[model samples]
Target: MTERTPFRARVHAPGAELDVQAYDFESPELIGGDDRARLDAALEAWGRQVGMLITAKTRAVVDVATAPSRIQSFGAFIASAEGPVLWATASSAGGRILYRIPLEEARYWAARMIGAAGDAAGDGAPLTSVERALARQVLTEQLAELQHATGGMFAEPVLEAFGTEPPSSVDRDAQAVVAVIGTLRRNDRRQLAAAIDAELVLQRLGAVAPHQDAAQVRTRIGGHLALAPVEIALRFDPTRVGPDTVLDLAAGDLIPLAHLADRPLVVTLDGEPVLHAAVGGNGERLACVVVSNGDLV
Candidate 1:
């Protein structure tokens, strides 16, 4: 009976938790890694989905020497239904990096998913299950779009591990988690390696034009010429015209074009003479001999 002290119970209100916010996730192990290409592709895809363009140089994983570790922040652009929203975040993935997104970025993405489901439904009403399925589909599609937008700059080997298709019932939270995990998969490592090698080859290949037969260039040039405009103009020399005497000036008098016989006509373009030819009769109409070598002007 020595322990007779009363024990008091502690109760917390619904909202009594401290408001300590967790910083954005980062991985120090990712720094100076051999799989930069896959990570880069993944980042690129993520950025694109958020309508953002980010650079690895501006971000940091962690300051290994500092207490509590710090990550650098960078700028980002987020797209919303209203327009682009701008914000910044400090990331701890590689170097000092920042992430900025629109205030409604998440909502905008959700809406896009809903819209995609609607499109897939045609005229039928979409059920909750159908909507969830569509949302997952849209998420995958949008992820691809992001990959393209970044030009494969952000690589993630993890995506290849899960294959292309995501789960059907993924919600927003699950989607985010899966996306990050997919970015970290081992298969992505090989993909990134291939991409790096390909990029290097392309860089070298772009340095010089491949040697082609002369006929090819000539053919190409001729095809280009065929698509260009051709202009033909006929010019007359004043000396070929007879003077309009007083007899020829009489009322209702018809003057014949007799001086247009056997004289060479000129063809010019932009005031530069290009050809000389004789004016001749073609049936009841007049024609010209297009001299190939003479100057027209």
Candidate 2:
């Protein structure tokens, strides 16, 4: 037993004391790597198709490069561009895309597309009504290509609206959305940046999963059936015999297939004629050389 000093306790007044608790907090789960990869591939395909369509429509060599996407705020992202943009939306995916083109480039593209002379002044002013209409039409074409490229993952894309200021708030965190940046190059000289709001990309990725599975099954079946063998019969001469004559024919009697010795030969698979050929030798072996290919008559 040892003597101890006097003990002292400190207390705080009501509403003046602070209580703190420390614990582990879990982070929100992001889109999985595999899911992200799938989405990326689809996006690249969509971008490629868009480039092809633009090139075909404008007669300009267009190239599109889809960069890796990230999760971020959509509103903040749009505001960062700091210029007028063309905004459009696609169904099913339920997302909008913003396209910003340099005035010179836009005028060039529009002029080339509609076969008109571009404004030479290159003034960075608002697009005239005619220019805006043409831009919307071109953008709508791009949307259609995207719809086809995505294979129903997204429905038709329509030009919803466009302005210097994008939709300030579409969703609570529309500010926090997935962003994919694509660069469209014209004639290897000018480039336009297109920002894709991928808020609905996850939905499109999930929608295509079932279709991908079914396509795999079809591919496997087609592959296996391609190797399946079929019978090919050679015809030399023809001899027609009725049912009663065939029953009475002796074993030594001949039943021919072709009428003439020099006639072109026919090959059949499952009683359906498939090819027309002539008899030929391959390395001292008799082979039916196919001279013409045709479907069954």
lDDT of each: 0.34, 0.59
Error of 1 at 67 (Å): 43
Single out the weakest 10-residue window by summed lDDT for candidate 2. 21-30
Give the backbone clash total of model 1: 25
Scored against the true structure, residue 200 in model 1 reaches a CA lDDT of 26
Q: Which residues of candidate 2, in runs, are more than 4 Å off? A: 1-29, 89-104, 117-121, 175-199, 207-297
Per-residue lDDT of model 1, residues 1-297, tens digit only: 565333222333435764444445431122223344444444444533432211121121111110111122111001111233222221111211112222232222344444432112123223245443433443344334433554554332222111122222222121011121111212211011011122222222232256789999997987765544344456765443347564468788765654466666776554566677776677986666776543433
Clashing pairs in 2: 73-175, 74-175, 237-257, 237-258, 238-258
lDDT of 2 by residue, 140-206 (tens): 7776766677667666666666544455434424422243434455334444454455546656666
- Could you say which candidate leads in TM-score? 2
Residue 237 of model 2, lDDT score = 43
RMSDs, each prediction?
Answer: 31.0, 29.4
